[model samples]
Target: MHDLIEALLLGIIEGITEFLPISSTGHLLIAERWLGHRSDLFNIAIQAGAILAVVLIYRERLWQLAMAFLRPGHAAAMADARVYGQPPREYAYRLAAAFGVTAVLGVLVKKLGFELPTEVAPIAWALLAGAVWMVLAEQLAARRAAVLGERAAITWTVAILVGVAQVVAGVFPGTSRSAATIFVALLAGTTSRAAATEFAFLVGIPTMFAAAAYELVDVVGSGEAAHEDWSALGVAFVASAITAFAAVKWLLRYIQTHRFTVFAVYRAVLGLALLALVPAAD
Candidate 1:
């Protein structure tokens, strides 16, 4: 029962933090200090649940992207292409480019055996650094938006940078993937907050699912699956999906009117507190 409760709490944390410009992995790591450590497979499973929620939320958009290729001359596809002054399949192509970059770099990172640090001090430092990065990036993006009037077009440069951002986030546990990608897109001249956020979230769906699959295969090959608590994992998965649905929905709406500065402020405070507390605890 206690384990189940812990699973539920961890799921809620994953769901709430996953889509936000706050690091979900950082939150999970902090929670594990008290709730007890979870296996990498369990963490990946909960993250997969969050990814499923994004999939559901963007079902129509995903369908349109598909139909754009599968059925040329699709009305929605034509409209999108016309508005963006690009080919009918441009959006899809950009998404592919971004995902490709991540896949290649991600594999290289894995091959190099660069693992996410589990230590609190490094995570705390990352959180603090990310907060500073967010502030500076947002200011630059806002200035660009003022001049460009909130352009929605994603340039090839933006696409490639966003992809690189994802790998950087993966290498740093406290750097939020969504935060990294979205800000990189913004800084790379994708001025519209909504557009940057959508691209980041869309790209994340596949990136995260791939990572989760890779981790799952590794865990199974190592025979660690046999020791996992299936019931607790199931509860965590369901809890993560439901909470993620709500969290992403809220974020989509929230970003339309607000800047991401609030999240940066929250990150700064939390990071500093952790930094102070961690040394004393040691």
Candidate 2:
């Protein structure tokens, strides 16, 4: 019962933080300090749940993109192409580019045996740095929006940089992947907040699912799956999916009228508090 409760709490945390410009991994790491450490497979399983929520939310958009290939001359497809300054197929190509970069770099990093640091101090520092980066990046993006009047086009440069940002976020536990990719898109001249957010989320869907699959394979190969609590994991997976659906829905609506500075402020406060508390715990 206790384990189930902890799983539920962790799932909620993962779901709420996953889509926001707040680091989900950071929150999970902090929660583990009290809830007891979880297995890598468990973490990956909950993350897959969050990814599933995004997949469900974007089903309509995904369906349109898929249909664009089947019916290239369709009126709706052409209209979407004009709005995005590219055909749906081209947009998908860009997404593929971003994913390709991440896949190659991520594999290389894994081959190099680089692992995420589990220490609180490094995570705290990363959180603080990411807050500062968000402020500066948003200001730059806002200025570009003012001049360009917002753009939905995803440039090749933006695609590549967003890919690199994903790797950076992976290397730094406290740097949110969505935050990194969205801001990188904005800074690379994709001025529309909605566009940048959509691209980031779309790119994340595949990246995260692939990552979860890789981790699951690793855990299974290492025989760690035998020790996992399947019932608790199931509860956590369901909880994560439901909560993530709500969280991402709210975020999509919220960004239409608000900037992400509020999240940066929250990160700054939490990061500072964690840093201060770390010394006492030591």
Candidate 3:
């Protein structure tokens, strides 16, 4: 019963923090230190649940992208007719390029064994750094708003830039993937918050699934899965899915009217609090 409760609590934390500019991994690490750590497989699996929520929420867009990929003639017709706001083909290409760059860079980093500390102190520092970047990104976005373009108008250069930012977020624990990608898009001249957020999450669906798959395979190969608590994991997975759907929905609505300054400040305060408390907790 205690384990079940812990799983649900951690799932709640994961769902709430995952889509927010605050790092979900960082929060999970801190929470686990108090509630007891879950296995890597369990963590990865619950993330898949959160991803399932994203898929359900964006089913319409996902269906359109699927049709565009499977039917080249339809894509061409849409492009020629300009039926959709943006050519599905162009959006598809940008998604591929952005995901490709991150995959390549991420694999290389893993091959090189470039890993960071999962310690709370390091996460605290990373949170501070991320906060600074967020503030600066908002300022830059405001200045360039007039000249900025929408998601469909993103160029190859911007896609690559945003992809690199995703890679950086992967490399750094406290850096939030959504925050990094969205800011890079904004800085790269994406004026519309909705457009940037949409692209970021769309690309995120595949990237996250790939990571979860890799982790699951590794755990299974290592025979670690046999030791995990399946019941607790199931509870966490369901809890994460429900909360993630709500959290993401709220964030999408929130960004439509507000700047990211609130998130930035929250990061700063949380980071400072962690810096002070983590050492004492030890």
Candidate 4:
């Protein structure tokens, strides 16, 4: 019963933080330190719930993209089929370009045995650094007077830049993936905040899904899948999916009319607090 409760709590945390410009992995690690360690599979598997939320929210657009990709002579007809003020093919191509870079770089990072510590200290520092980057990137975006670009405006270069940012976020636990990719897109000249946010998340669905799939395969292959608490995982997964859906919805609306200064401030303060409190708790 205690384990189930703990799983529910962590699920809530994962769902709420996963889509926000906050570090979900960092929060999960901190939560685990208090509640007791869980299987790495559990940690990764819960992300599928978050991905499912995204898919549900963007079902229409995803379907359009799929149809565009499958249409007869799509490569030659992309100039005609526009959906949501942009060609669906454009979104498909950009998403693939961005995810390709992330996928390749992520594999290389793992193959190279390059990993950052998931301890609170590293997370704290990353949070502080990401906060500063957010503030600066917002300021830079404001100065450009180029706030007209949408996801349709994401060029190959912008996609690559966002992909690199995703890779960096993967390496550093405190550097939130949404935060990193959005800011990188902004700095790369994605003029509108909504555009940057949408593209970041759209690309995130595949990246996260791939990661979860990889972890799940590893767990089953290692024969550790049998030892997992399936009941607790199911509860957590459902909790995370529901919360993530709400969180992402709120963020989408929030970005349309507001800046990300609030999240930046929160990250900065939280990072500082964690840095101070972690050692004492230990």
- C-alpha RMSD of each candidate structure in angstroms: 1.6, 1.5, 2.1, 2.4
Clashing pairs in 2: none
Candidate 4, overall lDDT?
0.86
Order of candidates by lDDT, top first? 2, 1, 4, 3
Better of 1 and 3 by TM-score: 1
* TM-score, per-candidate, Cα-based: 0.95, 0.96, 0.94, 0.94
lDDT of each: 0.89, 0.91, 0.85, 0.86
lDDT of 3 by residue, 151-261 (tens): 336677778988898889888889999899999988886777888888888889988998898888999999999999999999999999999999999999999899999
What does candidate 2 score on TM? 0.96
Candidate 1 backbone clash number: 0
Instruction: Rate residue 14 of model 4 by lDDT.
Output: 93
Clashes of each: 0, 0, 0, 0
Q: Indicate the residue-level lDDT of 107 in model 1.
A: 98
RMSD, candidate 1, Å? 1.6
Error of model 3, residue 74, in angstroms: 3.8
Clashing pairs in 4: none
Quick one: ranking by TM-score, best first? Answer: 2, 1, 3, 4
lDDT of 2 at 89: 76
The list of candidate 4 runs beyond 4 A from truth reads 72-85, 146-152
- Which is the winner by lDDT between candidate 3 and candidate 4? 4
Model 2 bad stretches (over 4 Å): 71-83
